[model samples]
Target: MKALFIPGNSPYPIFSHAPLATAVRNAGHQVLMGGIEWVLPNIASVGLPPVKISPVSMEEVGAFMGAMPEDPLDQLKAVGRVYAEIALDSLERLLDLADHWRPDLVVGGGMFYTAPLLAHQLSIPSVRLEWDRIDARMYDPGAESVLAPLLAELGLDRVPEPDLWLDVCPPSLRPADPVPARTMRWIPGNPQRPLEPWMYTKGDRPRVYITAGTRLFSGDALRDMARSIAGLGVEVVVGAPENVAAELRDQLPDVRIGWVPLDVLAPTCDVIMHHGGGGTDMTALNAGVPQLVAHPEYPTEATRRITEFGAALLVDSGGQEAVTEACRKLLDDSSYRERARSLAREFTELPPPAEIVADLEQLVAARA
Candidate 1:
């Protein structure tokens, strides 16, 4: 079978969809990925096969982000508008690509509007790989006005729903939202990199992994958090780019620093601290490590869910004292670790991505 995977024009979505593409390929299906040019490198970095879609300029995305309203619901609406605009911009090119490729099925990340649009045009089944809790605000009635022109152009009165929704969040961690979904095991898609010797070595003290993801690096705050945590008589490992690591080394001479893959470093950690990205949060859960998330911006659903599950703590104030206190609780409390392990077990017991290949095939056959 030929499968086309469409990731949104963002690094997060591209990385998130990589594992599913790999699973499909491993199941003896041909998989091809589509996204804007900017995110194609990230897809290729993970060694996934990709076919470039119509490019959306960075300036356009940047302007949309910059112009987003302060209210969270408003922000989601703004994002929906941007996605609709990008989808409209790329519609013709995407149609042409689909005509040439003639894929049996279409798969896309949850926020990627183009995949469903293209699939609707081709009259083929499409699946949305859930990235986080489905925000109803993103699908607000107001978005109809913002998207009406494009929807009219495509002969669609509204955005068509995907045939399937693939969710990776464990049942206990999922929100009470009513979206019917098929649960897939959370597989960390952090890019594969060389492992450092220290990653495998057990330290004398509890190990803590600290990261702020590739984007949204908190410069001084992260250094301060690392410094405070280092003084707690624990081993501090900072995952960052080489230049950032060098800068952090100046602030934390005793801390280990480098770009170690989260999949390798997470298992060694007793506690993980990060900026509350969905990918990082899921990685910590998969590793059975308790988390301390400091998100001054909108806290992701994963952050909230993990906290609700008692496996993690959220620090929204963005203060050093809050971060320090949360780290202390994560280190000193045994309940957090126990809950984390329980969540990890739940994730482990779910059917692996490869196991879902037959289900996807059935869905496609039914569509045919």
Candidate 2:
């Protein structure tokens, strides 16, 4: 069987889908991942062969994010429309590839709107892989609004749902209202660097790993938080791109700053402080490390759940002080680590990615 994986034009979406793509390929199925030029390197880095679709520039994605409203629901709606636009922009090239490639199944990241539309057009089964524990179906109404005209042109009323949903969120941390989904264990797909002894092994003092995610952060705020956290007698490690790491290193001489792999460093840490990106959040969750999220955006279902579950803390309003305080609380409290470890256990117990390859094959066969 041949499977086509479509990731949104960014690194994180591709990171979430890499484990499953690799799984399907290992199971002797042909796999191909498609995206704009920007994400081709990312796809290649994850050991998947990349097929270039149409272009959606980073500037466009930045503009869409910049235009998002303050309200969470409004933001969700806006994101939905933005992705719908991405689908429309890329669908022509995608269809052209589908005609040539003729994949038996389409596997897509949650926000890759092209997945369902392509599957629908080709009459193939589509599988949607959720990055974390949020209600992805919330984007449907907004997506449908933008896609309505396009659907009419195609002689369809609505975009069809994927035949399957692979949920990576642990059962305990799942949102109260979740779309019907099959559970899959979360796997860390972070990019790797040469491992140092300290990265894989724990030190004597409490270790805190801080990252700003792939995009968007305040250097001054991160520097302050790292310095302040260090003052409390804990080891602080910051993972970032080289340019940012150079800047951060100039500001803080004592802390470790570089591109440290989260999968290797996470287990050695007592706490992880990051911007509330889903990939980073899940990576920490998988490591069973308590979290301190200091993003400006309002809490989503995943963040709210972990915070409520006592495995993490949120710093929405306060600047560095609030973040430092949250980090302190997470580090000082034993309960937080206990809860995080418990959730990690739950996450590990869910089905592995390889188990789903057979299921996907069955879905394709059933359709035939």
Candidate 3:
């Protein structure tokens, strides 16, 4: 079997999709990753007028998006427009790949909405992976009005045949309400690292892991976040390029810091400061390190569950005092560690992602 994947712009998909990709290859299916460059032609599906805000400039993008009603219905209109933009910009290239790869199935993460169309065009079954359950009404406030209709239009109205859906989410993270009579399988890979290997120590200096920097990161706010950690006698590890690091370094010379791999450094740190992307959340939690998330616009279901599971602290991109205080609370109190550990216990108990991918292959085959 030959399998192809459609990826998105964010870094999270690379990690989330890795286990499944490897599993497919190991099981004798050739896997090819279709980078988002193919998504260009389909960008039209996301109408530009509704997607008034631009991805190029993050500062202007948020304020512009904010002006639109925060209601889910309005958000839906905006997201639809944005998705269409992505489709118009990338779809042609997506279909063209089929001519060569001749994949048996096209699997996609929902972030790139055009995958369904690509599957239809090529006359192949499309498998969509969801990190979290999709419940229209259960979203943060104004979600249902917009999300429900979109899913329906996408053919989610019917239970996918032979349980084609692979939802890695466990019962604890899933909403109270579920799609009735739909048999969903849990294929888990979001793995965990034991704390025995990674212990948290305050030492004479505090160690803080800042995941996302101001590339519209609330630049001053993130700088303030660094400052707050420094003031508290803590060391900061900011993961950014040389220029940004150089700039920030000029501002704070003495606080211990460097740009290192998340896998290596996150385990050594006491707490992680990030913008709540899924990979970072999973990595930090699995390492038994608590989180401080600066909530961003339009966080997906995965982001919502991370906070609900008590693995992280939600801090708005506001004043430094507030950001500093949240960091203090997480570092000073032991309760945050307990919550992260609790979630980690559950995250690890399920079957790893490799097994899940193999199960998905079986499911797809059964249907065929």
Q: Quote the lDDT for 177 in model 1.
A: 67
Model 2 TM-score relative to the real fold: 0.94
Candidate 3: which stretches are off by over 4 Å? 38-79, 131-163, 178-206, 213-218, 256-258, 298-309
Clashes of each: 0, 0, 31
TM-score leader: 2
Better of 1 and 3 by lDDT: 1
For candidate 1, the lDDT comes to 0.78
What lDDT tens digits, residue by residue, belong to model 3 across residues 1-368?
Answer: 77776545433454456567667777777777654432222222221111111132344445545666566466656655554455445555665666666767766665445555566656667776653344322322332243345447756642233134455554566656544322233332322344332234445555788865433343455566677777776777676656566666777676434445566666577788877555666667666788887754445575577667776677755666777788888889888788877766766776665665665566458647
Model 2 score (lDDT): 0.84
Each prediction's TM-score versus the true structure: 0.91, 0.94, 0.71
Candidate 2: which pairs clash?
none
For candidate 3, what is the lDDT? 0.57
Between 1 and 2, whose lDDT is larger? Answer: 2
Please provide, for model 1 over 253-280, each residue's C-alpha lDDT reduced to its tens digit, 9 standing for 90 to 100.
8888877888777888999888766677
lDDT of 2 by residue, 1-368 (tens): 99999967688888888989999999988999998877888899999999888666677767767777878888878888877888888888888887788999998888778898899889999999987765666787778888888899988888778899888888887767777888898789877767789889889999988886533354776677778889879999988778778888878888899888888888899998887877778888899999888773656777888899999988877666667778888877899999999988998799999998888999999999
Candidate 2: minimum summed lDDT over ten consecutive residues — where?
Answer: 212-221
* Best of the two (1, 2) by TM-score: 2
Q: Which stretches of candidate 1 lie over 4 Å from their true place?
A: 57-71, 132-143, 213-217
| Alpha-carbon runs more than 4 Å astray in model 2 | 59-74, 213-217
